[model samples]
Target: MIYVVEDDKSIRNLIEYALSEKSYQVKTFADGLDIVDVVRENAPELIILDIMLPGKDGIEILNEIREFSDIPIILLTARTDEFDKVMGLESGADDYITKPFSVLELLSRVKAILRRSAKKDTDHINYNNISLNTKKRTVKVDGKLIDLTYKEFEMLLFLMNNIGNVITREDFLLKIWGYDYEGETRTVDVHIASLRSKLLDAGKLIKTVRNLGYKFGEI
Candidate 1:
């Protein structure tokens, strides 16, 4: 099932109708007030969220959802500012669509995100006492479970998978956030910093490459 949270009744109905026409089960919400609790109870396959809401904004709701689940979220916004887009992407939104968007485009994005999420990697990666089980989507450092946000996990997995090689911020955006993403490269830095912090001492393995990017390996 899919969930759409939009304050505008017209837009909400439009989205609901469009998604339903595609044979997708959809639930609609007027605001983000009860989304977290509803998601906690029964997470949907994906969420279409409007950035400007009555109660909690989409970014706040995105952060709260990321705290527990990584359910794919596509943000909807009337604003065309870069700040809102960057903030949404940095806060864990899978994608975002500006207002006055085509329903066809929205459906396409929804389909693409759902398709990507369905694809899974079954490999297990271990490096420098950090254990990652891709199939299980779990990470352990020094034999203890470590909590990682969805982006953090993906960033770590990408780094570990390319040990001894330097990975640029642009590479990260293209690889983890998708090639079409237009957010600032600084988003990569923020996630890396948070990831390193959560990994504790093992964080040292992720070394900065001076003028280039980052490298994950023994220094």
Candidate 2:
């Protein structure tokens, strides 16, 4: 299911019409208040949020939702400023689209995100004594559970998915932080450090490739 949260009636109706026509189950909202309750009842697969709303703006709602859910979110707003986009991504949005967007473009992005998420739904990765359940988003090493933040879990998942292969910091920034992310490579280093600390003995599986990048699964 998809949730569309926009204050404008016409825009909400148009988005609903377009998505419903494509056979997607959708629900529309005119404010942020009701969404909090609705999500508690049943969370949608993806959310389309408008930055400008009656109150509690989109960023606030996005941050609140990230507290318990990692559901994909696409920000739809008229704010074309680079700072707004960066802030939205930093706030946990999976993608961003400025106002006056094409419905076709929106639909395509929705499909792509859902498709990628679905591909990762059922698969589990295991190497030596470490186990990662993608669907449950759980990690365990030597029969001990590890608590990881969203980004930390994703960073570890990406590396384990391509065991024995080197991945550059630039690639990590693009894939994990979104293509538009303006953050430096240092962000990757920081997250990797945290992830390694949590992984305990399994952390040694990840190795620095000497000016190239990072590689997982032994040297």
Candidate 3:
């Protein structure tokens, strides 16, 4: 189950149509106030939250939900300020997308985040032909060892841990780089590109979303 909160009728309907086409059960709300009770009564597996909403804003609703549940949430906003992105993530959003984003991207992010949230942690994670040994801090493709840099190893580990999640550049900076690491998000892109190249045949598993960050598993 998924809940989409957006005041824009066309966008809301479009989102609903996209998710429905993918065989997901969806509920749409035009106002933040209109969905609070429903969220409390029937907790959805995931939420597509729009920042600008009538009555109560998405941030306010997010705060309210955080007080009760830690369900995965993906924010939608028109703001491109880094401060706003950081604030949204700090406020408990698992992911976010800027406005005028591709419906394909949104749907991809939705599926990826849900897959990530549903995953259980284990010392060994194997997907396709790639294997990640968290306990040993090693990665192998087809039983052959693959050497990675300190940062690359950590990055791959993080991605493997989250699996199909859509991790924004902000998320990479906050998780891999220290939250206060005073560097541009481009550093993440560089590292990701390097990691992908090193991963060889398995590199294709790391997908890049235009204007967004990357998802670390097959969609």
Candidate 4:
């Protein structure tokens, strides 16, 4: 199921109609008032959200949703400003489409994100004292379970998968955030710091290359 959160009646109905034609189960919302709660109770496969709304705005809603779920979200914005786009992505939107976008293009983006989201890795990864179960989406350090956010988990898994290789921030944003954009390298740094902290002594396995990116395993 997909959730469409757009205040504009015409746009909301249009999205609902297009998604319905694709055989997608959709629920439309004129505002983000109850979206967080609804998502907690019955999370949808994806969400098409507008940045400008009557209350709580889309960014706030995005943050709230990211707290417990990494459900794919596509931001619907009429703003052409790069700041809004970057902010939305940093806040955990999988993708964004500007207003007056082609319905076909929107449908294509939806299908692509869904396809990526459906992928599952059933292998277990063990690096040093860290154990990760991709299929279970759980991480343990030194035999103690440690909680990690979605991005942190993915980042750690990717680094461990490529141990000893330098991974650039741009590569992380592309592979993890699912987008290629500038001025968001700090986002990677922030998540890396948090992940390192959560891993305790095992965190030392993540090495920082002064002028490059980050590498996992040994100094």
Report lDDT per candidate. Answer: 0.88, 0.85, 0.84, 0.88
Question: In model 1, which range of ten residues has the least summed lDDT?
Answer: 120-129
The TM-score of predicted model 3 comes to: 0.54
Model 3 ranges with Cα > 4 A deviation: 120-219
Report the C-alpha displacement of residue 194, candidate 3, in angstroms: 57
Ten contiguous residues with the weakest lDDT in model 4: 120-129
Which digits, one per residue and each the tens of the lDDT, describe model 2 over residues 42-134? 668789999999978999999877755566899998987999999999999999999899999999999998887676645656565566888
Preferred candidate (lDDT higher): 3 or 4: 4
Residue 192 lDDT in candidate 4 = 89
lDDT of 1 by residue, 1-219 (tens): 999999999999999999999999999999999998888666688999999999799999999887666678999999999999999999999999999999889999999998887763234565646778898889976457899989999999999999999999989998998885787788888999999999999898899988778999885
Give every collision pair in model 2: none
Alpha carbon lDDT at 10, candidate 4: 98
Q: Which regions in candidate 1 have their CA more than 4 angstroms from the true location?
A: 121-219
State every prediction's TM-score relative to the real structure: 0.58, 0.58, 0.54, 0.58
Could you give me the TM-score of model 4 versus the true structure?
A: 0.58
- The digit string of per-residue lDDT tens for model 3 on 1-219 reads 899999999999999999999999999999898676676555688999999998999999998877555568999999988988898999999999999899899989998998887763346666665667777888876556889998898888778778778888888888877676787889999999999998897899899988888888778
- Score residue 134 of candidate 4 by CA lDDT: 87
lDDT of 4 at 95: 100
Q: Higher TM-score: candidate 1 or 3? A: 1
Per-residue error (Å), model 3, residue 93: 0.1
Model 1 Cα shift for residue 198 (angstroms): 20
